[model samples]
Target chain A: MITYDDEVVCAPRAGTLYDVLELILDRGMVIDVFVRVSLVGIEILKVDARIVVASVDTYLRFAEACNRLDLEHDVRSKTVPEMFGSPVAKTVGRAGARRTARSLTDKVRDVLAPEHEEAAEAEARTRERAERPRSRPAARPRGEDDRPRSRPRRRTETEDE
Target chain B: MTAPTTTAPESAPESAPESAAAPKALYVYGIAPAGIRTPRSRGVDGAPVRLLTEAGLCAAVSAAPPRLRPRRRDLLAHQAVLDELAEQGPVLPMRFAVLSPRTDTLLTQLRSDAAHLTQQLDGVRGCVELNVKGTVVPGHFADLVRRDDRLRTLALQTRRRPDYEANVRLGEAIALGVRREARRAAREVVDRLAPLAVRTVQGATDDEQVLSASFLLRSADEARFREAVAERARACGDRLALSVTGPLPCYSFVDPRPASPAGR
Candidate 1:
């Protein structure tokens, strides 16, 4: 079994607009007479948000983490505590295992922040969170300190398709 | 942002290119019983919102913004209006970007659909929607590697071969295994929580988001529901990460023409 901070992992976040975007956009009522205007970049927003993990990129990353593991050890004798203490744990932890484990809200934040600099900054922040021994998802709901103060423009508005 | 023209304008001329921005058009936010205090929340494009009451039902509306885009602020405003209305009484939230061509047209629809809309509103009275989303957590790699013989064998082979193809194969297997575990945990979560809700609606799920479901819960039961979610989050924190988002307006439960029951 894997061990981590329950406070960080188990606490339910208050919902932000991003958390309920699907509900706002897709689930509400529509009168046949009233027009539902077609949005310019919303298709891309919706599509990018629902990305699946079954890809060569994900597979390669997983294989890379597995290669760094200590598979030569006797599985029967090895225990959870020893596994956690081993260099194997550090290898897997550092090798994008946490990256694969990111929550959907984090991906939505990345997709919404389209500026290259902002995206890179967001990436660095995500890495920082991943490297922490126990940390919450990178994007907190609306009023958190996770977003950089410098991000003024709504970059997601400019995305095409 | 380029303005997207309305798909089919009921009364606008074919020659008119910008009918959507016409001053006569009203952006409809939601419907509720008449006489609830007007929502103080701003509408899309920062327009002030008001109610157009007809046939005992009223819609929260505003002069349609000249240009409509799904900007973050506008979306929040739309939700805020419905949320405020929901606090007062049952509300039927319109999907974002719904625009009525004219006040008369909106009033006609309100009159025609009052019985159905009121019934729909009653279904969700005193209840709130709570959405639960669960994602895969690959934190159990050590445990998985130990328990699965095939995965262990692949890990061993990849270490020896150390080739690109071999790594991809090993990694693909691991990803699949991790997703499968998370999916199982997601099912267990829904099964555990569904009983606490009056009704449940399952949303689309992909490999990464193993589960996304909304529960229409009574206001009094919201605490019990949240406690149940917290317990499940603790139970499966290793394999799946769960987050709850709501007490929101009942967006998923407001369909007048309800979809066939799919949630189990």
Candidate 2:
């Protein structure tokens, strides 16, 4: 006779993509012989994800939430439930903190969601090209060569070491 | 950045010329000993998955994807494949986007590395990885302000003055106090839980997330482990919010090599 609340509280939560991002990206076996493609924008994504944690904006939000506390109330009575009961205090605390948290979530969402509109447009262009097969040798070989050149010489140099 | 265009005609040639040239490389998910059933989960880019057996081990892989990105669906697909494999037996999961240059290289690597890989797999068999993360709850700031005279005085001064500068100072102090308490609780949680695990690996933590650790535990002990976590979560609920993820594949516990032959 397990209660629903017990099940809710005790069950292990399914991990989200954000939860396992470090594991998939940073951990696991990579043999020396394999070439790890330099993923574009990965550095930006990692930095952006952690940026909100220590920002001055976050500090100010904490202060604002603390300011809403009713200092005159008896300290023992000021439990988390009581704090939740005050709509004004709850709203103020959430409003200040939510902005930074929301922005971080949005950044993660943008990084993870495939760019469907852009993919569709690219597909249309490819379809058009396929329809006119004899127009030109595809400009792709040059692009592939350019991709390898764009990789910094320094990265390969370090791998040699 | 936008997704890389993967439709290049030149992309085909590089993967095409090798013997058995299938116009695709193998996107490896993990390596397990021969005889486990193939995973039903879709592979990255929605390719159907199959196992390639050599020596005594089999590598679970899909047709190499044309340009890999950290798209949400693909990441989940990678995890799903490993998760299904882990259910059957021990698996050595590859990092995301590890492509074997050719089928020969993959088969050769498997044959040569079979002993090392099998020993590593045996080490993690019947165990699971449990990742615990804790973030500051921020609800305890009221108690913090009440307990410390310095913080109390600062709050009183801010209330009296109520200027932007005063408020900022007050806020910074409260933020520091909250983070300090959360970190302390995080240490206590780890201390209590680490003994339950065979190995503990700490992950990066910041001002917001005070605890990020993965624990490897025997499957039989998972219930007791969860009970311990729930108890700790209750004990520190006001100051820290803790979440447990897994009974997952032992991502953190696997050794890069099972000790050098000469212990190098």
Give the root-mean-square deviation of each candidate in angstroms: 9.7, 18.6
Give TM-score, chain B, model 1.
Answer: 0.88
Candidate 1 lDDT by residue in tens digits, B11-56: 4434434443443678889999999999987787777888989899
DockQ of each: 0.26, 0.13
Candidate 1 chain B: 10-residue stretch with minimal lDDT = B255-264
Please give the distance, in angstroms, between residue A110's alpha carbon in candidate 1 and its true position after superposition.
12
Write candidate 1's Cα lDDT for A38-128 as tens digits: 8888887676566665677667756755654556653322222112222212212221111112233343233223244445444543554
- Candidates' chain B TM-scores in the order shown: 0.88, 0.89
Model 1 stretches with alpha carbons more than 4 Å out: A1-14, A72-161, B1-23, B256-264
For model 2, residues A72-101, the per-residue Cα lDDT tens digits are 653322333123222212212221111123
Candidate that scores best on lDDT: 1
Candidate 2, B114: how far from true, in Å?
Answer: 1.4
Choose the strongest candidate by DockQ: 1
Please report the TM-score between candidate 2 and the true structure.
0.74
Candidate 2 at residue A16, lDDT? Answer: 55
- Model 2 CA lDDT for position B26: 72
